[model samples]
Target chain A: MNLKRLESILDDLEGFSDPNIRYEQYVTPSYVAARMLHTISLSNHIEGKMIVDLGTGPGILAIGSALLGAHYVVGVDIDSSVFQIALSNLADLDELFVGQPPIDFVESDVTKCVLKPKSFDVAIFNPPFGTKGNSGIDVSFIKAALDLTKVAVYSLHKSSTRSFIVKKGEQLGAKVEVLGQFSYDLPATYARHSKAVKAIDVDLLRFSHR
Target chain B: MKLLTHNMLTSRCLKGVTNGYPLKIVANEVKTENVDYNSEFIARVIPKVDWKVLSSTASDFGVSLPEEPPADIESNEDMLRKVHHALLEIEITQGDLICPETGRKFPIKQGIPNMLCNEDEVK
Candidate 1:
């Protein structure tokens, strides 16, 4: 509730870690994650409904959803290390909700993970677009993401890949809408030289399942 | 650039290289400044890094590092110090990042990458 206490809670959450993990990447920037939650609440006034974050690295969106009043949230990813981070972050959010939604972090490929079909009211994901010098954009991940919710929002790279995802979503029978876009000037490490100096256009897209 | 973007980039723009699988680096502006280093953050992030790409890129910038880092490194002050430097110290302010494929130039002005493609490229 207080500023100092909130900062300490975040420090503890940020301090959490794990090894031997894969695919749990990109702790969605909190401001962006918060914005995503805002967009969902604005698009449809569905309060206290079940929500899920498919690739919930560090559980920022999942925890933000809980803080924003999602009755329940399931944050899924293939990496356990990221789950650990998410687990800690969600702890700080417990105080915000009165009988809040249980935020569960499952370590599994979202595509193979089982869900309450058509049960989730909203699903949000900031999937791993690129990894280890490789890009992981594909139809299967999108299909899997769409299968679990009535409406889904995605934070995606603004590239030619956007066209591919839109086409795929429409074929699967959801009205696709791009919500908003922003750019990030990511710093570079010694290992990665490109310095992600480009304006990484982050798009918020909605798949309105009719 | 963020590890997320580097992971998806290809060097298809390099002339005479068919796949251009990895783009080579020619960094003009490299600064090591204000980025913060949370050990927990680095520990969580190690798994996501493309070491091969990272090492090679670092090498281009004249920073030599091992391909496989030792475990239990947190206790090693020297190693942790180096990791800290590598992860958060460097900044890229002005330069041209070439797309390995298509040789598209994404310029970095004041540390911002302009990835805008022309109308023809967009179509």
Candidate 2:
């Protein structure tokens, strides 16, 4: 599907009902998600590939991957509460994906989940940027994602951590690239929100194991 | 959870457990549906699957498959169809995935498995 079409589809997805600040459950703008998935699709990495979305809240990326022809897609998260909404999102679009791989969601910690390592072809996620008390948690998500995929990982991190993330990826022996940057206009969904909406700079980074 | 997903999960998250694979399945509900067949994709992914786990799991749902990928898997349309069905079609709507080692139970409800362990149980 075209970028505009993809974004429109993602726009209809449900967001977290009770947003948890501890997990940094910020909404991923449909426009930004479309751009990230579109870029990965352009690179020819998604089709017929086993794809996993770490910290997949609302299942936007996971649902989008199945819609785009992924052979299999699994979305893992610590929050079971969001599974119903995420599953409902898939059910809402079930008619469109009658022939696609089964899209499954698992409830578990992103870094500590028991999913097999080096099993998936690609990993995509908008991991928490660790702005909360859980400092350095994004690194754990990145680490788990890199360990899960055989070829590459696509993730979003705060632009402020670009250098640290780059260095971390290098230290983990993966080739890292800054695909693009986005300004996340996060809705004041949790207690931390001072305004109705806040804008945070996010960088889309691709970590390739080559 | 589909058998394909169950084939990849383990209890390694539990403290003191290593290689907690081939999690035992205890299903309270199982659902099946037909999806468009894609042999090419199925053929490519077969190698990555744990065949022994998959074959045994298939039987639990009354869908029998070979103990391993058939020797002629690439061209075996009959086997591919069964593989596709077992992997993607058979969903364990409610169940428990027990670790072979610690026997720790991870509950699966409404088709989603809760694989999270308590902080104290985390290694």
Candidate 3:
């Protein structure tokens, strides 16, 4: 499927009904998710690849990867309530790729899960930006992804954290690249944000294992 | 959990477990469903899999697998088909994944393995 069609389908995905500040839960915008997947697909990474989506909220990235011909997609989330929403969203687009790779959802904390080392081809996640009290969470996610991945990790983080991410990537012996930048619409789910929608800059960082 | 997932999982996180790999499978139930086979996908996944662990686990489930993956697996259609079956077709409906070192059992229900451990189990 083309980017437009995939984004249109992902536009219908449900977000958190009651988001938690502790996890800094914010649904990744469909446009950003589509763009990231499209870029990865262009690099010849999506097809026939075992993809894992950590902290997959509503399974947007997982579904998009499956639509783009990933061999298998696994969506892991700590929150159980989002599974139903993700399943429904996946069911809606199941017929689009009749014989594409199968996608499965697992409810578990990403950090604590026992996924085999170097099993997955690629790991993708739009982790919590660590803005709300939970600092350094994104680093942990990147570390875990690197531990499980054989090729590369595609992550979304605030552009401001580039230096920190670069340092972390260096320590892990992976080369980090800033693929692109996109504006994220952080919906005012919490009362602190006075505006209905707050725009923030996010960078798509690719950490390729050396 | 399929043998594919089992091949990747290890019990290294369990308390006092060293080289906690290839958790022993005690399957209470096993099921198989027809899935479309993709030779290219299977070929790509072969190199990433732990062949020894997969072979042993498949044998426990009565599924036959070659002792080692073929050197020319990319071009071997029969080998690819066998791998596709072993990895994706077979499913563990219910079971316990026992850590090789600690003997701790992680229960599986409806094909989802619960790998979470108590706070004390965390290193």
Best by DockQ: 2
lDDT, residue A182, model 2 = 94
Give the least accurate 10-residue stretch of model 2 chain A, judged by summed lDDT.
A184-193
Per-candidate clash tally:
16, 0, 1
From the highest DockQ down, the ranking of the candidates is 2, 3, 1
User: What would the per-residue lDDT of candidate 3 be over residues B17-80, giving only the tens digit for each residue?
Assistant: 7778878888899888565678888887888888988777777766787898878889999878
i-RMSD per candidate, Å: 15.9, 1.8, 2.6
Q: Report how far residue A45 has shifted in candidate 1, in Å.
A: 5.5
- Per-residue CA lDDT of model 2 for A93-196, tens digit only, reads 86787653478889999878699888799999998877777878988988999888899999998888899999999899899999899987876753256798
How high is the TM-score of chain A in each model? 0.79, 0.95, 0.94
DockQ values per model = 0.01, 0.71, 0.46
Each prediction's whole-model lDDT (CA)? 0.55, 0.88, 0.82
lDDT by residue for model 2 (B1-123), tens: 988899999888889898899899999998887766789999988999889988998998888987767799999999998899999998888989999999999999998999999999988
Better of 1 and 3 by lDDT: 3
- The sequence of per-residue lDDT tens digits that candidate 1 reaches over residues B1-123 is 322233323433234435544544446777655433445545544554466776666656656768776677656656655654554455555676676666666665544344434334432
Query: Which candidate number would show the highest lDDT if scored against the true structure?
Result: 2
DockQ of 3: 0.46
Worst lDDT 10-window in candidate 3 chain A: A98-107
- Superior by lDDT: candidate 1 or candidate 2: 2
Per-residue lDDT of candidate 1, residues A35-128 (tens digit) = 6667777665224555767767677667766655554466766554565566556555655555423454444456542333454667777766
